[model samples]
Target: MKIAPNSRVLITGGASGLGLALVLQFVERGARVLATDVHEEIPDSLRGLEGVSYLTLNVTQDVDWAKARDWVTETWDGLDYLFNNAGVAAGGRIELSEMDQWQWIVDINLLGVARGCRTFTPLMKEQGSGHIINTASAAGLIHPPRMTEYVAVKAGVVAISESLFHELKPYGVKVSVICPTFFKTNLTESLRGKDEQANKSAAKLIDKAKLSADTIAARVIRGIEKDRHIILTDRDGKVAYAAKRFARPLYYSMMKKASFQMAKKD
Candidate 1:
């Protein structure tokens, strides 16, 4: 999984956010990237980038994934890395969160990653050398209140990556799950919920976060280079995971306090 020059990489959700960040970094490193997003036309940021091609791919659709798989197999012959970075955010009190909303997020966030893995895993297994990096969130590891949909799907991503890690290990393929906390990104473009206040709170955390997508991408690249299984891209995320692991009482207290604060805002 060394990201060498001319490395063949496919990234989903490449129009914006961490996906775009990874695209830019990988391109700068001289990798050939097929940066796929939902936009029909090329995204402004990727319009004229050399060594990067834009492909319209909605991760939720089976047809789109089939097209991607064919293109990668025919054009590049094989892929070096598959970045399952497409996802959306959803939040609300459990009772207020509708079934449809829950299903929508599950389709895009959890099943989207699942589809990517399913489609490309066999390709990698055949090649015997490839990497899959999934963009799971810190919410996956440490669940807070009011983000059940997001948390559930992200935790699913973590589970998927961990399972694939052992499954693909013997074959020389690598797997890494990125569990990043709030960061500066446009991940909120897809945010939705019945609770406006709770939705805004979720968006605000991302808006006010200090770490830039590039910084997180850099850390992720490093982690992938070392073949790390779980990558916490920020200090807050690392501490939270640690707190939840060995200090359960303290972690529960902190989450409870935060829940009350969110309730006050609501």
Candidate 2:
């Protein structure tokens, strides 16, 4: 959990956004890293790195995960950390969002993380020391309107991560889930929805975010060092979670008010 020198780390979705930020941060911290993505070509950010390597891994594909597992088991012989950070975005009311879109987001966002855990958990259990970091979202916690598909999958991620945290603890492995609010990232590049206004509003909030991926990644690194679980990686996220917990009636009122106002604008 210290991210010690030469720590063996593998990160998914490393081509861009928060995943890219995590890859760079790990490399800078003297960790020997494998940065994997669905893209065939390596990102320029990870090119020609000494301690960092790149591989093609589609988190939803069994073959890609098998390849990634083999790479870690053969080349590094062990893994210190596995980052299940690969995910896409989707937003719309339940009736508005297509079933195919729901399936796509579920496959990549929730089940993808589950697959990563299933693939590497035995390795980590055998090694007796490893950490799993999963990426959830504040939407997972807030359950805001107009994001049914996205919220459901992310909430599932949060659930699974908490389950894994307890399940892996007895095996000497650790699990942490990060629920970050909108930050400066390309996460919306994969956004899918039937509601154009919802999509645009989501993208606009992301554009207006003051927190950068680098800042969030840096905070996550610190949280990992301390073995902290359930990291809400921004001031807004932290405050919102606090408000939700301590002031439920007020929180629900605000959420309802915001939803109606947004709908009126649309």
lDDT of each: 0.92, 0.90
Cα shift from native, residue 224, model 1 (Å): 0.7
lDDT tens digits by residue: candidate 1, 169-266: 98888899999999999978888889888878878888999999999999999898887989988899899999999999999999999999878865
Q: For model 2, give the RMSD to the true fold.
A: 1.0
TM per candidate comes to 0.97, 0.97
- Clashing residue pairs in candidate 1 are none
lDDT (Cα, 0-100) at 101 in candidate 1: 97
How far does residue 51 in candidate 2 sit from its true spot (Å)?
1.2
Local error of candidate 1 at residue 200 (angstroms): 1.2
- The lDDT of model 1 is 0.92
Alpha carbon RMSD to native, model 1: 1.1
